[model samples]
Target: MRRLAIPLLLLLAACSPANSQPAPPVGTKADRLLVDKSERVLIAYAGNREIVRYSGIRFGDAPTGHKRFEGDERTPEGRYTINGRNPKSAYHLSLRISYPNAADRAYAKARGRSPGGDIFIHGQPNAWPGPPIARDWTDGCIALSNAGIKQLWDIVPDGIPITIRP
Candidate 1:
């Protein structure tokens, strides 16, 4: 019994909420969308308050590298706007991220490359047909669960600003 006691106690500790960390502080608004690339979290805020937080988002299949080149398969960093929505997305649904803005174009042009665009925030496809697993999976867009994307579609409007950070 003594030999089993330590293992049992460790298991209990692992399951204890006391050891679980609290969620990061969030505001209560729906104005801004903030993505923390390192944490892979997307927070929706209205003014200074947070409306909701979406976790387990998939990023560019090619993270940790520079974008702005065509076919790089990378998500761009910095600020952008939600320019449009697609009800008939190749995925379930999609919110367009205005990529290749002026600065992005300039940067790409400086390198003699095209700043590839067509970025989006969207849900999994009917073909893929399910929630994202516990890791990143998208080509260069932010992906959410079908249900999560639906909720966001109802709340987020075109022209909202989004900040993607490292």
Candidate 2:
């Protein structure tokens, strides 16, 4: 009975909402990506109107701590732009999120550490092939399902501003 309970717990944890649901499709050109770190949600807005929202984001493994160096597993907090896209990515597909802006670079340089680059808003890994994982598993990068990413690919373009708030 205890062994069965253990497997059940594992399955329950694996299927939890930590990672679930596809992100909303990208809308008009004026749409903005707004991240509320407190809620761990990324919402798309068109001039104060909500269009879509993605939740269950996993931030730096150390969410309460400040990002120090590369691989610190901390999603940056600040204003940035969507600079590019990658059809071939280690993580299925990805939308480049510009991190280490001048400010971030300066801060990291002062501390003698790399601000860590290659931050992206991306989808799940191919290994998870069945479907999007039921919870967050990124190393500080925003993640969407394969289908959600495809939807975003159609709507979002390069040079769009992204505002990330703590």
Candidate 3:
């Protein structure tokens, strides 16, 4: 199953087109972010205007369903905030996602499990020896190319609402 995901992710990145290279340049910063898991697309919105759309997003190993517990390897589904940014992260750059809302914690606790946290929308691992994207790899956070993340890092500010949908 894991082996299959790697190839699928590689294909996903290859086939999907990225609109991150918006021409004419965007003049305003993004106020919200939207992730469509089925299409592997992330869109940033300034007010009602769509600024950029990033395709071929990589996810966790499972790549299905809302994350319920630690080690589920499932990208979470719901609304969250860009709580913080990491300039000195393990990845090229990272914007922390605030997962495990109160509801998530309650659900996991009911099942005697930890609801897991520390998710982020980030780029490739720093000092990685392999290609930029060898796999759709992360515990359960969103992954993007170095250039894609750099573009996002420049436009998206902290405390913006981000919604991840199935």
Candidate 4:
């Protein structure tokens, strides 16, 4: 019984939420955001100084390559801006990403398809139970926790630059 109990406790600890680390100090202003798709992380920066890093991120259902068109189920890669904000987002809070840039539009147009837009860095689903989803789930957006998104919403204003990496 003792042996079984110790192993069970260890398993529970391993399955626990990874967002246990205290967030970095919030800054007065954040100018840049960086998303590492492969690494599944989103980082906020104040100039050259790193202010906040959010790990254990879940990306689009198709978690690789650049998003080219609507319903691609892949996150777009490259430079973009925080073009909008939704204080009453369905998924807690959301910061809109400016996808379908000129290059994106051109590529999709050449392919005779619409380059999808309406990408965002958002929070978890409001209806879900228990902890956050543990896998890639968004259609073509970035997802964080409700609390995480709130913090981000407060700091990262519209027009901030974001660079998404493959």
TM-score of each: 0.79, 0.77, 0.85, 0.89
Model 2: what TM-score?
A: 0.77
Cα error, residue 106 of model 1, in Å, equals 0.9
Q: Kindly list the per-residue Cα lDDT of model 4 for residues 85-108, writing each as its tens digit.
A: 987777878999999899999999
Kindly state the number of residue pairs that clash in model 1. Answer: 12
Per-residue error (Å), model 3, residue 10: 16
For residues 77-145, could you state the per-residue lDDT of candidate 1 as single tens digits?
899999999999998799999997898899989989989888998877769843354455677888877
Candidate 1 Cα errors over 4 Å, as ranges: 1-29
User: lDDT (0-100) at residue 38 of candidate 2?
Assistant: 78
Give the alpha carbon lDDT tens digit for every residue of 35-75 in model 3: 99889888988889888888878889888899999999999
TM-score, candidate number 1 = 0.79
Report the poorest 10 consecutive residues by lDDT, candidate 1.
Answer: 16-25
**Model 4 poorest ten-residue lDDT run:** 15-24
Residue 33 of model 1, lDDT score? 93
Worst 10 residues of 3 by lDDT: 16-25
Error of 1 at 107 (Å): 1.1
If both were scored by lDDT, which would come out higher, candidate 2 or candidate 4? 4
The list of candidate 3 runs beyond 4 A from truth reads 1-19, 23-27
- Per-residue lDDT, model 3, residue 47, is 89
**lDDT per model vs. reference:** 0.76, 0.73, 0.87, 0.87
Which clashing pairs does model 3 show? none
